[model samples]
Every structure is written in structure tokens, then in C-alpha cells.
Target: MNPLAHLRPALDAGLVELGLAAPALSARLLDYLALLDRWNRAYNLTAIRDPREMVVKHLLDSLAMAPFVGDETLADLGTGPGLPGIPLALARPGLRVTLVESNGKKARFLREAVRRLGLANARVAGCRAEALDEPGAYDCLTARALGTLAELVRVGGHLLKPGGRLLAMKGLAPADEIAALPPDWHASAVHALRVPGLDAERHLVVVTRRAA
Candidate 1:
């Protein structure tokens, strides 16, 4: 029996709250969480150790971005342990996701997760966002706790095709970071996200290149 099985109710409730209730998807999310829990004991891939907290902070928090996602090729830059990338892929099977991570251990974990989860639409980049060579290849890019808006664009901007958007998950509204955005890019929209079971504030900053 999976030790994390007890948290299934919480995960299901959170998914229903997010309007993403699906039995299969929720089960897969739990499987990924169990895998992460197992790996953390040996790799320390993430700091959040409790499985219940992982359902809220990791699974629900990541799936909260589902409504904002579209059917486009997405690159998840600096995806430590495949937060939004993995969950988003699991939620929307048609959306193609590329998990970009430079850390060797984390990258290994990501690849394993993708394979074990049978994520046919997801792949791992296993390189730094800036080092990733597929220029102007993606329709959108996502980052969670990666860096400031400016810093994120500086590193991963090349991955976006023309008119592509960057959906950045941040804690609180990063006004300072928004103001620091490069001249070529602008915050097209800012959405305050409410993750079920989470008490803190979360925001999604959508950025796009300036019209030439």
C-alpha cells in the first residue's frame, strides 16, 4: 500500500476546486508525489517533506496554472523536480511540455518521472534555460520560483517564438520585478491564483514581447 494514499481525498478535493476533477489524472498525480517522496529521502530534491503538504503546495499549486495554459509547446525553465510542468502535463494530456533543468540530480529525477508516468507529451531538456539551443521553438514558457521576471526572460527568452508568452508563477504580486522587465517585454496580464488548501497569495505574471 502507498503511504501517500491517505492524501488522495485532499488531492481529489483540490482538483474539484480547481475544476480539474478527473479520477485518472488525480491518481497519476499521487503516483508522481509518491515517487518524489521516495526520491527525496535519497536525493533531497525538494525541501517540502510532508506528503500532505506536497499535495497542496506542489500538486494543487502547479495545477492552478491549468486554466491559463493553452495547447502549445511549453518549456518549463528551471523546473526543480518538475513542479508545474509535470502536473500541467498530467492535467492536459495534449499539451506538449519540455522540462528544462540544469541540475544533474534533478534532471535525472525529471527524466525518470516522465518515463514512469508514461508522459508521452512531456520531455526533459536536461540543460540550463540559457544553454538550451532550441531558439524560438516554443509557443510558451513557464517558470516557478525560478527567478525574477527580468532574470527569467534574460535566461529563457530565446526559447519563445514570436508573440510567445511567459507564464511565471510567483508568490505575492512582484511589482518590483514587473517594473524591472526588459524594454522588449511587457506584463500583458497578471492573475492572482488561489490554490485550494493554501493560505498564502499566489500570482501568475503573463509576459509577451513588445509589438514591433
Candidate 2:
């Protein structure tokens, strides 16, 4: 059975239709997943052992956010296995993505993926997002299935620039999370996502800091 035969069509079609797929993007997605699977055995990089799940959850879910962020520098906080970070970077090569991971093992995997994939524009910061000296220095701060609304906003808020957004890939409507933000923060639309070939509850929460 050809692995790419069945899966490529839907993904390629979706990306092209949405204007997200670029040259070599699909190939890199395969490489990225292969590396993750290879390393997971030795390092436990991700919970989803099945490569197919990696495609649906990690790859597709991450790519789903591509259209939203659109051409900006992104910082992915607590990028455990590069869920949305790596895939997002692959989907849009023009975007400068920094994957922030505190655990040395996970960080190493991210760096390995970067080098192997030849992602010159991507960098992996093996440090806590809070410790990174540059505050609010990115056009967007992103996280996928990372934390509670408060915990997510609390840690990731500082990474976004003054007007930059925090894009959280969550399971359902982020109403509770949105309400938790101070009144000053703006809660943009919570767009529902329809990721091809995957049955998962997906939502993209766009947020900004509360004005003082």
C-alpha cells in the first residue's frame, strides 16, 4: 500500500484550495513525521504513536492554523513535540517560527527536525518562554493543546507584540478562556476548523493583550 497515495490527495487538495500548500511542503511533512516517529521510541517525543495520527493530529491540525496566522513571525510556547509549530512552519516556509521548549529532549528533537528538514527560517529555543529575554517580541504567540485558558494566556501573553495575537488551537469554543481574559484584552472570533480526513473538535482562538 502506498502511504502517500491515499493521504496526499486530500491534503494536497486542501492546502492548494486554501492557498497554503507550497513547493516541497508535503514532502517535508512526511520527513517531519518520519523523524518524529523514529525519535519517539528513544525519547517519547509524542503520545500519538501512529504515524497516521501524527498526520491527522499534528500535521493537519497544525496546517489548519496556517490560514489564520498568515505571514508573520510566530513563537510557539511549550512546544512539546512541535505540534502546531513544526507543521505550521512547514506549511508556510516564509513564516519565521521559533519553537520554545524547556525540556532538553523535546528541544533536541525540534532542533533535529529543523536541521533535517533544512528549515533555515526556523529556530528552536531550548528554554522556558518566560525566561526568554525578549518580551512581546513576536508577531504572534501560538500553542496547540498546551494549557488551560488562564495558564495559556498567563505564560504566552508576553510573547506577543503590542498588537500581535495569541492563537490557541483548542478543542471547542474558547468562551470560558475568553471571558477569563481581562476586559482590556480583545477576544476575536473563534473560528471553527474543518481539517480534512480527521474527526476532531478543533477551534482557533485569536486573542490580544488587555489594554491598560
Candidate 3:
């Protein structure tokens, strides 16, 4: 049986559970997985070698945060292989997604993925998060397994609009990291995400700046 044929049902079932039952979006997500699997062979973008694990860990894990993303424009900091950003863009065509990756090879892969996927709403930024000087530019900012909560805010805080939120995807609830957040920032909410087919603990931390 074809690899995609084996993966399609799982992806479809996962998407439906996530309330993202659009056929077109599901196809794009599978295409992205194929691209990532191909590139991982050469670039070693992700350590997980099995495509089945990729479906659950990469695709479904990222899509789990889709419901929390309500911003028109989103910036994905340290987006290696465009995990959640690309998938999110596929799910929400109207969302403007900027994928920021400092690695040249990963950045190139991201550019190619965007081109190949025909994701007109997504773009790649080959630079570090702190280097991005666009203050209050995006309505929401996202980072998946990128860094601690404090570090993420310190680096990408400027990219968020005044009332925007930072959606950080983590394996477990980082209570210490949340407590260490800067005085100006506050933890608005922490949502426990139940990614389909993934048994690990998944959490989405929503952070915002304190009002003056």
C-alpha cells in the first residue's frame, strides 16, 4: 500500500476530531508531511524518522493549537520546517503567517514548502526572533517547543500587537517559566490540548502584556 494511503485515514480522522474537516485543508496537510519527510532525509530537520510519528507529533500536534489562534496575522518564531505555522496557514487561508527560522537550510526548506504548497498567505523570514524589530506588527505570535516562556517573550514580544497574544506550545505546563515571566507580561490562560493520536501531555500557554 502507498504510504500516503496508510496515512490519509489517520490524518482525516484527526482533522475531523479537531473540527477541521475541510477536505482541501486535509490534503494540504498531507502534502506538507510528504515534503517534510523528504526534506528530513537530507536536512535532518526533525529527529522523528517514522512518518506515522510525524503525522501525530508534527501535523496533529501543531493543528491542536488552531482553535486558540484568532489573529489575522501571526508570526511563528523559530519555525523549523514550518511546523504549526504552515499547517495553520493551510487550515486558515485568510491568516497571514510569517515563519521565522534562523537556520539557512531550514529557511530554504520553508521557502520551498511555501512555494510548493502555494501558501500565498505564508512567508519565510530568515532571521532570529529578537532580530525582528517590527513592534506591534502581528495580531498573534506562536512558538512550538522553541524556548521557555520568558525567553520567548523577551525575543518575540515586540512582534505582537498591543492587544495581541503569544501562543506557546509546550509538552508540559511550565509553571516555573510562567512564574519567571517579566513584570510587564502576564499569563492569560493555559489550555490543555488533546492532540488526536498523541498520548503525551500537550499544553498551550497564552501570554499577554500587563496594562499600563
Candidate 4:
């Protein structure tokens, strides 16, 4: 019996609420959850140990950004255990996702997850976001629970194409962070994400470079 089977009903309901309802997608997400649960036990990949909580925080929260993601190359900086990166790749097969992590252990897990999940659309970059040499390569970038907007752009801004955007996931609307953005960067939009079962505030900050 699948250990995560009991959590499927809630997950499916959450997917339906998010307008991403699909049988196969739900199954795959659950499989990924199971894998994450297994690895978390030994690797301590994440603090949310409860499977039900993982369904809410990890799967649903990550999928919340799906509608905003375009079918373009994306680099997920500071991707610890492939939060939105893996989930986004699984949800959008056409999307090419790079899971960028500096930690050796996390990178190893990312590689194994990619191989085990058969994620042909995803790859792992085991290096700091600043050290990644691929400038102007990605059409979009995502950093979840990474850092302040200024710090994130400082390290990963060079990776974006001229018109590329950074989708920074935060717990609440960050007005101060937006104000602190370096002169060259700006917040184009702020999207409120409603992750089912999670009552806490969630926001996606769409940041872009200023016109020269």
C-alpha cells in the first residue's frame, strides 16, 4: 500500500481548487511527495515532516505558480530539494527547469530525483546562483524562500535575458523589499497566491530589470 495514499483526496481537492485538476498529475505529485517524504527522514531535506502538511505546503504551494509560468527555460536558484522547480517541471513537461543548489547533499538528492522521476525536462546545477556562468540564458527565474529581493537580484540577476523576470515566492507581500530593490531592478507585479489548506499569506513577486 502506498503510504501517501491517504493524503490523495485532499491533494486532489486542492489541485481542483487551483484549476490544475488531473488524475495523472495528482498521481505524479503524490509519487514525488512520497519520494520527498522518504528522503526527508534521512536527509532532513525539509522541516515539514508530516505528509499532509507536505501536500499543502510543498505540492499545492508550488503548483500555485503554475498558471504564471510560461513554456520557457527557467532557473530555480537556491532550490533546496527542488521545491517549485521539480513540481513545476512535473506539471509543465514543456518547461525546461534547472534546479540550482550549492549544497552538495541537496544537489545529490536533486540529481537522484530527476533520474528517479524521469524528468527529462529538468537538470541540476550544483553551484551557487552567483557562480552559475549562464548569463542571459533563462527566460525566467524562480527563487523560493531564498532571500530579500535585492540580494536575490544581486546574485542571480545576470542569469536572466534582457526582458526576463524573477518570480520570487514570499510568505507575505514585501513592500520594504520592493523599495530596497537596486536602481536597475523593479517589481513589475505582485501576485497573491492562495494555496489550499494553507491559511498563511503567500505572494509571488514578479521582478524585472529597469529599461536602460
lDDT of each: 0.94, 0.79, 0.91, 0.94
For residues 98-144, write the lDDT of model 3, one tens digit per residue.
Answer: 99999999999999999999999999999999998788899999999
TM-score of model 1 vs. true structure: 0.98
Superposed model 3: Cα runs more than 4 Å off = 1-3
lDDT tens digits by residue: candidate 2, 23-135: 47877777777788889978998888877666777787788888876678999988898878888887776889999999999998998889988988789998987787768
- As a whole number from 0 to 100, the lDDT of residue 166 in candidate 3 is 96
Q: Where does candidate 4 clash, by residue pair? A: none
Give the Å shift of residue 96 in candidate 3: 0.4
lDDT of 3 at 111: 96
- Output the lDDT of residue 127, model 1: 88
**Which 10 successive residues of model 3 have the least lDDT summed?**
1-10
How many clashing residue pairs, candidate 2?
A: 2
RMSD, every candidate, angstroms:
0.7, 2.4, 1.4, 0.8
lDDT of 2: 0.79
Query: What would the TM-scores of all predictions be?
Result: 0.98, 0.90, 0.97, 0.98
lDDT string, candidate 1, 164-192, tens digits? 99999999899999999999999999999
The regions of model 4 sitting more than 4 angstroms off are none
Candidate 3 has what TM-score? Answer: 0.97
Lowest lDDT block of 10, candidate 1: 1-10
